[model samples]
Target: MTGHVVWHGRRVAFRRGESLASALMAAGVHNLGQAATGQARGVFCGIGQCQNCLVRVGDRLTEACLLICEDGLIADPDAGGRDG
Candidate 1:
């Protein structure tokens, strides 16, 4: 099944079983957030090993590469407090 998730307040479509990182990247959202040194961060390991893809899902910080895309899922890049 296909559905949409809220990314930075915008709706991004994704298929069931797809990771949040994959879906966001497919939707042209490459820059997930900023690093502590003001460098842009994105998917690196694609297996949740790297902390580059961290984003705030609701109130908790998680790796987007490991997070499955679900309907109505909300991801806020700025909420992770990594925006430098």
Candidate 2:
């Protein structure tokens, strides 16, 4: 099944088994957020190892590559900020 998630307040569609990173990338959202040094961040390793695809899901930080896309899910790309 396919559905949409709230990505940075924008709706991004995804398949049921798709990861958050994959969904965001398909929507042309490459720049997930800025690092502490103001460098742009995105999915690097494509796995949960690099910590580059960090996104705020609810009140916790999680790897976008590891998070399965869910309908109506709210993901804050910029929520990582300096602490990411």
Candidate 3:
């Protein structure tokens, strides 16, 4: 469960049992977060209040903190400020 997720064609380590948000941050994607107001954010309220670290999992919107990543999880990191 340790392959990689392409970031701008750059292969980034993808842990099978880690949070996508955490992985993205580790991969230097901490500033890539889409907020409801169309602003930048990233797990502001790590507990889940801000809804900042939202991402897509197989076409479904799921919280990075609430979801455990798995192998082959094609994570489309949402940078800038846009909805997933």
Candidate 4:
């Protein structure tokens, strides 16, 4: 079995070792993270290049495009939360 992601308290399907961005997309989440524009903002530059797809992994923040998904992970959006 892959894994599951908690989006806004909603349990979503995900695969282990897969990037958060891909998982979000599989879950039909376009707005990976909120941007200066609004909640409908998303970006490219996958991997560890850009910090566009930022999300909260547990108590820490991480790039959704790069960080690999794990089983039972609580992920949340955080575009306005951190600038890193």
Candidate 5:
């Protein structure tokens, strides 16, 4: 099954049970965060152990790889003006 999700104010398509990070990457969104040295970051570890693939879901910080893609799921890649 598939669902509609929004990322960075843009609509994206995702399949059920899929991670938001995968959906974002499939949509050509690899730059999920910026490093202090101005480096782009995405998924380093597919599991939730790593905090590299962090994104904002509402007001909470969550790991994109651990978050299941769902309909109407809203996420901000650069939330809190981090890495931007």
Candidate 6:
């Protein structure tokens, strides 16, 4: 089956070799979360060199830009945690 992932209780469809950040952007999810002091943040760097596009995959923090879209992957854009 084609790759897919969930975001904040919404099932998002993705394709093979697609990045989580790209999937999110395609789904119109631009604002990922806040930074140190609850500041708005998103994909600053398309690569994995930045922490702007961090998201909560289950309970662990992952870089959306670097994480490949996988089937049944659960992600919380507003997890209310550090990465959220």
Worst 10 residues of 3 by lDDT: 75-84
CA lDDT of each prediction against the hidden true structure: 0.88, 0.86, 0.63, 0.74, 0.83, 0.82
| Residue pairs whose backbone atoms clash in candidate 3 | none
Tens digit of per-residue lDDT, candidate 5, span 1-84 = 498799988999998888999998899889887655666778998898878888888877888999999899999875335543
Ranking by TM-score: 1, 2, 5, 6, 4, 3
Model 5, residue 9: distance off in Å is 0.8
* Candidate 2 local Cα displacement, residue 44, angstroms: 0.2
Q: What digit string (tens of lDDT, one per residue) describes model 1 on residues 1-84?
A: 499999999999999899999999999999998877777889999998988999888668899999999899999784237442
Cα lDDT of model 3 by residue, 1-84, tens digit: 476655334466767776767777788887645555667766767665667776655555667776665655665556434444
TM-score of each: 0.90, 0.90, 0.66, 0.78, 0.85, 0.85
Compared with the true structure, model 4 gives a TM-score of 0.78
lDDT of 2 by residue, 1-84 (tens): 489999878999999899999999998999887777778889999979999988888877899999998899998865346543
Off by over 4 Å in 4: 37-39, 82-84
Better of 3 and 5 by TM-score: 5
Return the top candidate by lDDT: 1
Sort the predicted structures by lDDT, highest score first: 1, 2, 5, 6, 4, 3
Give one digit per residue, the lDDT tens place, for model 6 in 1-84: 386798888888888889989998998989887776777779998998978898887767889999999899998765346432
Error of 5 at 21 (Å): 0.6
**What would the per-residue lDDT of candidate 4 be over residues 1-84, giving only the tens digit for each residue?**
476878768777876677778888887887866776665444478766777777777678788887777777788777666553
